[model samples]
Target: MKKFVLFSVVFLSLILVSILFAIFSFSLLFSQDSGVKEFEENFNIRLPRGTVSEKIYDDYSGFHNDGVKLYKFVFTPKGMKSFVSYIEKQKDWEKLPLSQSYQALIYGGEVKDFSGNVTGFGGFAKEVGLPKISSGYWKAIGDKSVITARFIDYENLDIKTLINLNSYDFYLAIYDTKKGILYMFHINT
Candidate 1:
């Protein structure tokens, strides 16, 4: 009789503990901000409806204490239109003109110096860990794409200027209409 009572008591205590743990876990899961909501809050922009894919990359270099946050997303063609429209309405965002070298900014390509010498360059898409697209892919679809930024020197879109920036807040968004991809890259130094 004693052993039976003791077993019953232990079983009840375990059940009670399990119930409490479940309640605590559920509260935490629901109360915390979700990834999509957090992304919107951080970037000051909402993900358009039908945004299908999201890739976020964050890194803080221990050597220089510099950090970068990159977000790459795939949107439906319709969703891309809606997002571009919404971004266009924002006061901070300025639509960039399609320059001959715009593709080199987001997609890896050869860069040229002021002297017209071939200079090395890197692209944001690869930095953000997005899938590699072939060279000239963006250039081929350039006419249909749209780019906007908080600020960038349209004339001096070179690696030197980008590397020389100091303590700047830069926001760039590129919409590849052909592939329905959106790339948002922000640099904080």
Candidate 2:
């Protein structure tokens, strides 16, 4: 009887420990300052477990009825893979090739220095810290990285179509495998 009781206590202790760990993990991901909740609420997509927000930018002009939101998140390698897999399985997202035209569209016009030399695009995307690919930005994702967007017929569309988008309403997720970071950009007008 004592042996059985000991086993029961051990098992119960293990279960309790597991429950606490799960709670703690959940809290860490969704904490007020984590930005996970806001991102999930706005995008209707939940980031992978163990992901943490690194930076966020929110701009809105309710009067003008247009705004942009950008979020940067760092993920564990495993979490990054998991997110890529999840996005791949989602019907709404379309993987986009990492092309110069799309990069231009995302970054807007070329930025120029005081001497009129082209620097790079200067916008909230720059402010949010999207990797600067124009100057060989190493942090910028490459061919191996997954780039996915939504709200357009990407299959039949070309870069020109993306460039011509008037009221840009789209969601883009770019994964940096080397740095294990995910950059999300959203535009609504």
Candidate 3:
């Protein structure tokens, strides 16, 4: 009787371990890149290579007209430094340029520059401390541009309505100069 009980205990333990392992392996294989892949497919743009995505928030219904999806990507200290260097080299890139389809979706007037005078976007300003706007990469780019891309689908309608779909709206590449962290905001549907 004791031998049978011992055998049952070991078998159950092995089964439990195997189940947990399978669950973990399945999650690792299927769940890792789903959000990033969806974003790329929807927006038709690729995120910068080597950066790690920290969190993806899909706000189906929120304060905005429609909704907003926030994808926060983090970079290592070394990677941040390298990206800043690369941006400095791309002086004539004209910051963020919205594509033609993106342009049609804008409900309001035009996209504006949200950088100059302000230290940083969202919580980064306080997090990184107040950076010297006149020195380093900040000074290189005279005016920091914040381009808004608000996407709306007017498929079968004769007249278009200015409804904010909030899907794949616009992206902001906010860099924390002091900490070398780039906050890439993808406001979308």
In terms of lDDT, which candidate is strongest?
2
- lDDT, ranked from best to worst: 2, 1, 3
Rank all candidate structures by their TM-score, best first, as comma-separated numbers: 2, 1, 3
TM-score of candidate 2 on Cα atoms, chains taken together: 0.51
- What's the lDDT for all of these models? 0.54, 0.58, 0.42
- TM-score of model 3 relative to the true fold? 0.39
Q: What is the lDDT of residue 166 in candidate 1?
A: 44
Superposed on all Cα atoms, model 1 deviates from the true structure by an RMSD in Å of 8.2
> Considering TM-score, which of the candidate structures 1 and 2 is the better prediction for this target?
2
Model 2 worst lDDT window (10 residues) = 136-145
TM-score of each: 0.48, 0.51, 0.39
RMSDs, each prediction?
A: 8.2, 11.7, 10.8
> Count of backbone clashes for each model?
0, 2, 7
**Candidate 1 lDDT by residue in tens digits, 1-189:** 999999999999999999999999999966633444544554556787656545478774634444556666766667777876776666544344334354565555776667667754465557777554332111111111113323555333445554444433344555554465665555544
Give the Å shift of residue 186 in candidate 3.
Answer: 2.5
- lDDT of model number 2: 0.58
Model 1 lDDT, full chain set? 0.54
Give the poorly placed runs of model 1, Cα more than 4 Å off: 1-13, 16-21, 24-35, 48-53, 56-69, 74-82, 96-120, 127-163, 166-171, 186-189
